[model samples]
Target chain A: SQCPQKWKRIFCTRCNSKRHSRDRCPSVWRVYLLKDDRPKKRKKLILPMHSIYCYNCGLKGHFGDDCDLRRSSRVPNEDGSAFSGDNLTNSLKKEYFQ
Target chain B: SKDEDANILNMDFPWTINRDHSKQKEIADWLTLEIRDFVSYISPNRKEIELRNQTIGKLRDAVQHHWPDANLHVFGSYATDLYLPGSDIDCVVNSKAGDKQSRNCLYSLASHLKKEGLAEDIEIIAKARVPIIKFVEPLSKIHVDVSFERTNGLEAAKLIRGWLDSTNGLRELVLIVKQFLQARRLNKVHTGGLGGFSIICLVYSFLHLHPRILANEINPIENLGVLLIDFFELYGKNFGYDHVALSVMNGKATYLPKSNWKELHPIKSTFQLAIQDPGDATNNISRGSFNIRDIKKAFAGAFDLLTNRCFELHRAKLKDRQGCSILGNVIKYRGKARDFRDE
Candidate 1:
C-alpha cells in the first residue's frame, strides 16, 4: 500500500510570493534570466580651502599684535594726515575723562 | 572473559559490564586509588611548582636543541594564580633567530618525546608563521597554550604587563556600564557582549569625566597597576562602590529631576559634538556648525564643572542627617563601608 502525499510550503521568487512552490510556478526560468538595468551614479569631487580667521590675530585674517597699520601709525603727506602715538593716547584719555 | 570485562569496568569510560561483582568492585577500588594518587600529585605543592619549572626548562632545552636560538617564557593564569589547579599553562616561544631551524627543532623534540614514550597521549600542535611546538600532556589534563611569536625585544615585554594592568579599571568600568544599560534595557550596542568599541566607549566616558584619571607620577608600569586597582575600587562589588549607583545618583538615567536638566545638557552636547564630522559641511550646517575646537573646549569645561564641582556640592549636601544615610546606604549596599559595632 502507498502512503498519502503530504503538503509542504514552498516559496516563489518571480512575484516575491510564498503561495506556491518554484516547480509549480509558470515563469520560473524567466525570473532567473532577467537582468538588472539600473545605471551607476557619478562621484562628487572635493576641494581644500583655508578659513578667514587667523590664529595669530584676534581679528579676521590679521592679529592685533601684528597690525602693520597700527605699527607705522602715520600716513604719507599726500593729504598731510599725521597722527603721533602721544596725540592718540591723549585723545583717548580726554574721551575717557569726558 | 568475565575477569577481562571486570577489568574494563575499572577503566575511564568505554567499559564493559560483567557478572563478577567482587572483581568489578576490586577494579573500581584500584581505579579510585589511582585517581586519588594522581589528584594528590597534581595538587599545589613546592614539589609540583618545581616540577612545573622543570617542565618549562625541559621545553626550553628541547626548543634550543632543535634551534640553537629560541627564547621561551611563561605567562597567564599560571603566573598570576597563588593557588591554581586545572589552570592551563601559557608559554610563548620566539623563533625570530631563524624560522626554518626553529620549526625543525620543534618537530625533532616532538619526535624525541615520542621515542622516549612520553608522547603517548601528548598533543603536538605546530605553527608555521613563528614556528613552535605546543606540547600538551593528556594525563596531566592541563593545557599549555603555546605560541611562537617574533621577538619584539625586551622593552616590549616590559611594557606588555603594564599596558595589560592599566586597562583593568577600564574593564570594570565597561562591566558597570553594561550592567547599567542592562538595568535600563538600553544595552543594544553590545549584542555580541562587551566588544572592543564598547570598552573604548567606557574608558572614554571615564576619561571624559576625569582626563587626569590615568595620569600618575610613578613609573608607567607601576602606574598601570595602580590605575587598575583604582578602577577596581571604583566599580568592583567587592570594594562596595558601584559605578551604576554612582551613575544613577549623578542623574545619568532617563528619570532625571527638572533641576538636573541644565547640568545634563552639556553632557548631551558633548556626545552630539563627538558624533558630528567636521569634514562634511552640509552635515555640519544641518547640525548648526559650531567650531569643533570650541565644542572640545566646552566639553572640557563642562566635564570639570559636572564631575569635580558637582561631586563637591553633592558631598556637602551629605552633611544633613537625612542625606547622610542615603549616601551611607549607597556605600553600605555596594559594600564600600564596613558595619561598626559598639564593644
Candidate 2:
C-alpha cells in the first residue's frame, strides 16, 4: 500500500497495493472498525457496498426490497396486473400451471 | 509561516491529491470556507444565546413558582450549540409521566403562561407521539416546545456537544449537513422527515466511521468537504437501510442477526429510514419520514449532484442566497417520491 506517502501516517502490512492501505484491500475485511473505544478481538465490521451480492433477497445486483424474483413470483391478477395479496399461494399455483 | 502551514497539512496534502480526487484537500478547503461562512451567518451569536438563556431562566422561575419540586429543563439543540437561527427551543418539564397527565400539565402550564402574559398561540399537540405544549415567546421571538415525556435527549446532546468540542471540524461538518437538510425541508421529524437531533446523530455516526477524521490526520474543513461527498455516496449507494444500526456508542454500523431490525427496535421497521436514536435504541428517529424507496431516491439525487461538478455549477446558479446558503436550491430540490401506497 502507498499510504505512507499519501496518508503520511498509515502503512501497509499486507500485499502493499499502491492504490489503498492494507485494511482497505479487497482481500482484507470490508471495513475494519472497533467495537468500542478499547481495542478488542471482536472488531466491528460493515459489508462493502460495491459487491454484486444483495443484502435483501441474497441474490445478485438488486437488494431485498427490489427483488425481481420475489416480484415475478407473485401471481398475476384477473386483469393480468399483480399485487402481493397472496403472493406465495398464487406463485405456487402459477408455478403449477407452468 | 510556510513551514507551519506545511506542518498543519503534514507535507503531502497538495502533492498527494495529484491523481486521486478522493484525497483532494483543496476542494475540501473551499467547501470548509463556504460552511464557515454559512455557520457564522446562520448560528446565533453569543449575545443572542445569552438572551435566550436569561429568558429560559425566567421561564424556569415561572415553573418553580407553580410547582416547586418540578423543574423545566432545557434539552435539544438550544441545550447544545446546534440550534439554528429562529429554530424552536425544545424543553421538557421534568414532572410526572403519563399521556393524560402530560396533557393536563401542558394545559395547566398554558393557562399559567397566559395569565403571566409571557407567551401566546398556546396549542397542545395532545395526541402526538410525544405530546408537547407549543408556544411563541414574544420577547425572544422564538417558538418553544415543552414536553413532559422524558427522553435521553439532554444526555445525548451533551455527549455530541462534547464530541463537537473535542473534534476540530465536527461542528462544521454537522452544521453543513444540517443546513443541507433544513434547506430541503428534510430535517423536520414531525412532518414525516428527519429531525435536528437525528441529523446530529447521523453526522456523528459518519464522523465516527471515517478513521482519518478520528485520527486528526485530515483537516476538519478538508474532511468535511470530502465527507460531504462521501456522506451522500455512503448513505446514497452503500449503507443498507435494514441491516445496520447507526450506533453512536459503538461508533460503527452494528450489523444485526435478523433481516429487518424489528427484534432490535419494533418501531424502526415501520419507517423507510433506520437511524437509531443514540438516547434510546427502541425509538427510530425517522419514524415519521417516508419509506425506504423514497429516501434512497433523495440520497441518490444529492450524490449525483455532488459528484458531478457540472451539475453543481448549474444548480448553484439557481440557489436562493439569503446570505451564505450555497445549497439553497440544490439541497431543497424535491425529487419525485415512489408511492408506497400499493406496496
Judging by DockQ against the true structure, name the best candidate.
2
- Candidate 2 Cα misplacement greater than 4 A, ranges: A1-98, B1-25, B96-102, B149-151, B214-216, B250-271, B279-283, B310-343
lDDT of 2 by residue, A14-71 (tens): 6554554554332221112222435364343322222222322323332323334423
Predictions' DockQ, in order: 0.01, 0.03
For residues B1-343, write the lDDT of model 2, one tens digit per residue.
Answer: 2434433244212211111232212333444445454455456656676889888988888887877667788888787777666778888777543232466777888888878876787888878877788898878777988887575766767777777776656676676667666766667665666677667766665654443333223445544545665566555555555444454443433323123445354433322556665556666666566644544556656755654542233234333211222233234322221111111
Candidate 1 Cα outliers beyond 4 Å, as residue runs: A1-98, B1-51, B75-87, B100-106, B115-132, B138-140, B152-157, B164-343
- Per-residue lDDT tens digits of candidate 1, residues B1-343? 3335444444332111221112212222222222222223223566556767777776667656656676667754355321124445766766665454355555666676556433444454554443445546544544565556543323233432343354433333333333333333333332322222323333433332221221111222222322222232222211111011111121111111112233333323231112111122122111222232332232233222222322333334333312111111111112111111111
Relative to the true structure, candidate 1 has a C-alpha RMSD (angstroms) of: 30.4
lDDT of 1: 0.32
* Interface RMSD measured for model 2: 15.3
Which of the numbered candidates is closest to the native, going by highest TM-score?
A: 2
Lowest lDDT 10-residue stretch of candidate 1 chain B: B237-246
The local lDDT score (0 to 100) that residue B127 gets in candidate 2 is 89
Identify the leading candidate in terms of lDDT: 2
List fnat per candidate, in order.
Answer: 0.00, 0.01
